[model samples]
Target: MTRTEELFLALRQQIVEGKIPHGHKISEPELANQFQVSRSTLRDALARLKSIGLLVSQPNVGYSVISLSTEHLMEIFYVREALEGMACRLAASNITQEQLQNLRDLLESHESSVQLKSGVAYIQEERDLDFHFVIVQASHNPMLIDLLCEKLYFLVRMYRYQFGMVSDRAKRAFFEHQHIVHALSVGDGELAEFLMRRHISASRDNVERNLLVNKGVIS
Candidate 1:
């Protein structure tokens, strides 16, 4: 990657990983110095992250990491349900046997982790992402891939990471993924879409309930 792209990737990773923390102010000059890049390059990188809604830029206020409210969580998943559900359907028709096998392998690994009570580990969560990502790519639509993999996927990860993933939730999510992949393996487009939509909707509900509980708005 070119220097600009490299810097962009670097900063983006930190933001999504919550290394810099949500709503943290970003100083362009300090970041430029830290990355040893010029101001223009840093701005380019920040702008790219900002474009994806990870950062907000305001006049006189500079940049701050975007916070995920319960409302925003629902909004993000609403789009996720539409886009990823469609991707799952297309994937059922378009995915190759090799890709299907890869997903199986991923689930197999997850199975081992779950059995060992390590399914909620950050590594497993990332591996879960790999399983979904493969399915999204299998959709064979460049626009869908770009929208999910490039943009919204990171935000989803950010929310998941920030909110938390308990072992039980992770284990349950793993089982759901198995069902979705099974639909894909069988080339059942409609089933895959239904299962995938349900999967994302479940995640949104889980997050919403958790947020409400945290706020003492729900038991």
Candidate 2:
């Protein structure tokens, strides 16, 4: 990767991982020095992140991490439901046996990781994306994947935080994934799509509930 690309990846990972909290100002000069890159290179990396809605740039004040809010969460989940629902439906028709086996393997690995009580930090996120990405690819829908990738950045950032708030939510999500996979394995498009939709809807509801509870808006 180019230096700028490398920097962009690092910064984006840090932001999503919560190493840099929302609304925190990002100092270009400091980052440039830290990464041992020139100001232009740092600016290029920051610009890429800005385009993705992860960072907002001010004329003179520099960039700050974008904050997650209820409105934003709703919008993200709405798009996810439509796009991911379609992906699941298409995957039901197009998924190969090998792909189905891969999905099963991911589920098995996820189950093992959770059984060890390994905190669901990296493994959960990795397996979750793996399962979904497999479905997305099976759909053979390039445009949908492109759009989903854009939205996924912010969704991952926001959901990861809220995910941590929900005890054992990752394991619950894994079980939901298993249901979808089982339906897919049987070539039941309707049931697979239904399960996938319900899974995403539940996640949206949980995220909204957590936000409200955290804000004292719900009992």
Candidate 3:
């Protein structure tokens, strides 16, 4: 990767992992010096982060990391329910034999990971094999890929990392993934869409329940 691209990814990881805490103001000159990059290069990276909604720059205020909000997280889940559902439906039709095998392999590996973690939610290790991400790519729809994978996925990971979000339904989620994959393998677009939507809905419900009961985020 080029210097600017490298800087962009580095800053993005730090921000998403909360190394640079949410709502922390960024000083361009200081950040540039810290990273040993030029001001222009740093600005390029910051602008890319801003494009993804991770950072916001005001007229006089410069840039600050976006604060985590339960409401926004729920909003994203709703969008994922719709878009990823459609992607799953399209994937049932457009997916290649190789893609199908890749998905099956991914599930096997994910299953092993889940078992190793004692039913804990498996984190995406191979970026390409992130189950949902791979399914979306299988749709062969550039718009859907860009919206979900490029735009929203990182934000979801950010929330998970920052909140230490771990679902009690990890094993159940793995089963749901299996069902969705089966529907895709059989080229059942309707079933695939329904299963995908239901999976995302369940996840959103879990997050809402935890926010209310555990975090008391909702009154």
Candidate 4:
């Protein structure tokens, strides 16, 4: 990968995992030094992250981690529902046997990871993404895939932070994933779409519950 891409991934990882905390200001020079890249390369990386809404750049105050407000979370969910719902519909029509098998393999891997009680956040996160990305690619729509990629990075960050807030969320999510995959495997496009929409909508509900609990607005 390019130096700029490498820098962007590193910084994005840190921010998403909460290593860099919300509202924390990112030091350009420090980041440049840490990544062993020149300031210009770092700036390019920062700009990419900014475009994804992970970081906010100011005129003189530099860049800070973007804070997620309730409104922003709702917006993210709205876009995700539309984009991912469409992806599922397209994938149902276009998905080949090979792609379906690949998804099964990913699901098996995720199940094993969960059973083993692995605490590697990145691994879990990637496995979850692999499941969705396969469907997005199967859609055979370059425009849709591009848009999903842009939105995914930000969603990953937020989801990872809220990961632990819901009880057995991952376990439930795995089952929901299996339901969607089953529908796809049977060539049931409408069933697949319904399951996919419910999966995302349920996640939105869980996240809202998490936020309410965090704010002590819900018992």
Identify the candidate with maximal TM-score.
3
Estimate TM-scores for all models: 0.89, 0.83, 0.94, 0.83
Per-residue lDDT tens digits of candidate 3, residues 146-166? 888887878877887876746
In candidate 2, residue 165 scores what lDDT?
42
lDDT of 1 by residue, 61-169 (tens): 9999897677787888899899999999999999988888888987887677644366554234552347778889999999999898877878877876766656346
Q: Model 4, range 84-161, lDDT digits (tens) per residue?
A: 878888888889898988889888877777442543222345523567777888878888887776656555555556
Best lDDT among the predictions, by candidate number: 3
Off by over 4 Å in 3: 114-117, 216-219
Ranking by lDDT: 3, 1, 4, 2
For candidate 3, the per-residue lDDT at 92 reads: 99
Error of 1 at 215 (Å): 2.2
10 residues in a row with least lDDT, candidate 1: 120-129
Better of 1 and 2 by TM-score: 1
Query: CA lDDT, every prediction?
Result: 0.81, 0.75, 0.88, 0.75
Which pairs clash in the backbone of model 1? none
